[model samples]
Target: MSGVTAGVLDEAIKKAAIAWVSVEDGPAYALWCMPAENSIVVVSGPGEQYAPGLAEATRATVRLRGDHGGLILVVDAVVDRLEPGGDEWNELAPQLATKRLNASGTADDLAARWAGSGCAVVRLTPAADSVVGAPDLPADSAAQPPRETPARVETRRPFRLHRVRKR
Candidate 1:
């Protein structure tokens, strides 16, 4: 890959808080990840962000946004799952837990929970040569309709303060 493409990929992945991953032509799922040693690490499953098929997927498409919040880099990633108590997992899980926003417990606590709770920590190594950026971006928007969900806001009565009228 050229230096320019590499720079774009690095900048996009480092600056974005979330990445959109698609497996087997499925809908892109937005997942939180931490960039590590030229790869992205993501924790998924119950009690974490949903990334169906990613645990077993061998390859995936990863899209990242630029500083302006637009799709900046699209690349193919080689997926590899890490063993729960393996060296790589042990090294990365704590670090990723620390970076997890709105986490309820300490990094060690979360990592331990993940170890026992069937959470999968997968690495996404970008295929540097497959990166698409800049002038090579597709012309049409890739937006998709929202998926169905059971969640909805309930209507409620509003409360207001009562005041005496001046004469």
Candidate 2:
């Protein structure tokens, strides 16, 4: 696999629909996010799924996937919260909500509620030259790769089928 570069990472962030993220060495989880000018914007709180405390997080790691399954971009991030109804939230909320394009009328309401005291909009900015490259595979990663299974071969005639009565 080729090592990730700044441009490649940015492009992956732009094209990816969801990201696997974690903060402060916490368990990694999937989150829906949007790529902003210089950072990735993620939302979490009471109503959202995988709500990590990004506001209080100092460090974060985000993994973005490409169209192909094996294309992964891993970046170390700095997590921060955008002020409720502030410039950053206002700018990114619409972009973030684009993922739920079929929400119809409910999107605005959801956005408003998320912008309220209940939820938080977190920005995960890529740290300066902090690209955490592809993860090293364990020794057993390919232990089961495409090996033939041993099986007994039946040389007798095909077994007869018995038809059961309809209940």
Candidate 3:
């Protein structure tokens, strides 16, 4: 069952690690992305990542999860919203703050706080020419897949301290 070109969907959206982002009607986010030149730069609001349609979405559906998370590439994007000192935010906010993860700051202080405020930098670009996907509604919840892998330890038994006799 091959055929998923465009360099295997841009090498599975640059070896995914987080990009569940689904919009065109909201809800379905996981952000923390960066792999432009074909688009996939992300970032949302508050504390970081909540992707509620970056100031009027254009279209989206990028799910690229793998590395045990399964689902490898399901793009169909074309959304843009990179305001913050333009020029593609001076070239993708320091490569999306060096593909942040534990960053807390640095990478030019997260491209200067996402070019100084509001935190957006969205850009998906993948609509057709491959990566066929554009159906909608996939903010999946209640996912099940853990039937048990051996690792349980709860012996229980320890709690005795009753003292109150003097009124």
Candidate 4:
């Protein structure tokens, strides 16, 4: 089955975080990460909806997910519960700061940051040119080939035995 795209998964994760923060009344935002690729995408609404809360939550989630492995987060709504400099907001600022500063780095550097946060990173994109053409296989090989027969089978019936003595 086709798996969800990294971008799609990132959007979903952000929406979930927004919902978690009860920012349904505000605008929606999304955050996603390609852990293997050590990449993150942040999308905010046209308005200033869940941008703040979504941003904060996204960072925390990224850090947490990074601990186990890389993750994607999406925030669906905006919440105005806290100011950017407030204690709670400041506490979460580091993550956002990291996101901003590391925004343009190599995947390896991104992976390092994720690892520093005690998480793993990955990239989920299928390698380009992987499906450019049909793969060649040996002519002798068959797809869904027939199964081989067993060498021997046991029977329930018993056979009479004759013994011969050797001098």
Assess every candidate by TM-score: 0.87, 0.71, 0.28, 0.21
Candidate 2 collision pairs: none
lDDT of 2 by residue, 1-167 (tens): 23556777777777766888877666667787877877788877875766566667877878777778553666788888887678877777766766654555565577887776477778888875767555532233222234344774559976769865878
lDDT of each: 0.88, 0.70, 0.70, 0.32
Assess candidate 3 and give its TM-score to the true structure. Answer: 0.28
Could you tell which candidate, 1 or 2, scores higher by lDDT? Answer: 1
Question: Ranking under lDDT, best-scoring first?
Answer: 1, 2, 3, 4
| RMSD (Å) per prediction | 3.6, 9.3, 13.6, 21.2
Off by over 4 Å in 3: 1-18, 21-31, 34-38, 42-61, 64-90, 93-95, 98-105, 109-124, 128-142, 146-160, 163-167
Which of candidates 1 and 3 is the stronger one according to TM-score? 1
Model 1 residue 50 CA deviation in Å:
0.7
Evaluated against the true structure, the overall lDDT of model 1 is 0.88
TM-score-best of 3 and 4? 3
Of candidates 4 and 2, the better by lDDT:
2
Give lDDT tens digits, candidate 1, residues 21-97: 99988999999899887889999988999999999999999999877888877899999998978899889999999
Q: How accurate is candidate 4 locally (lDDT)?
A: 0.32
lDDT for position 33 in model 2: 81
Lowest-lDDT window of 10 residues in candidate 1?
1-10
Q: What is the TM-score of candidate 1?
A: 0.87
* Candidate 2 segments whose C-alpha is farther than 4 A from its true place: 101-106, 134-167
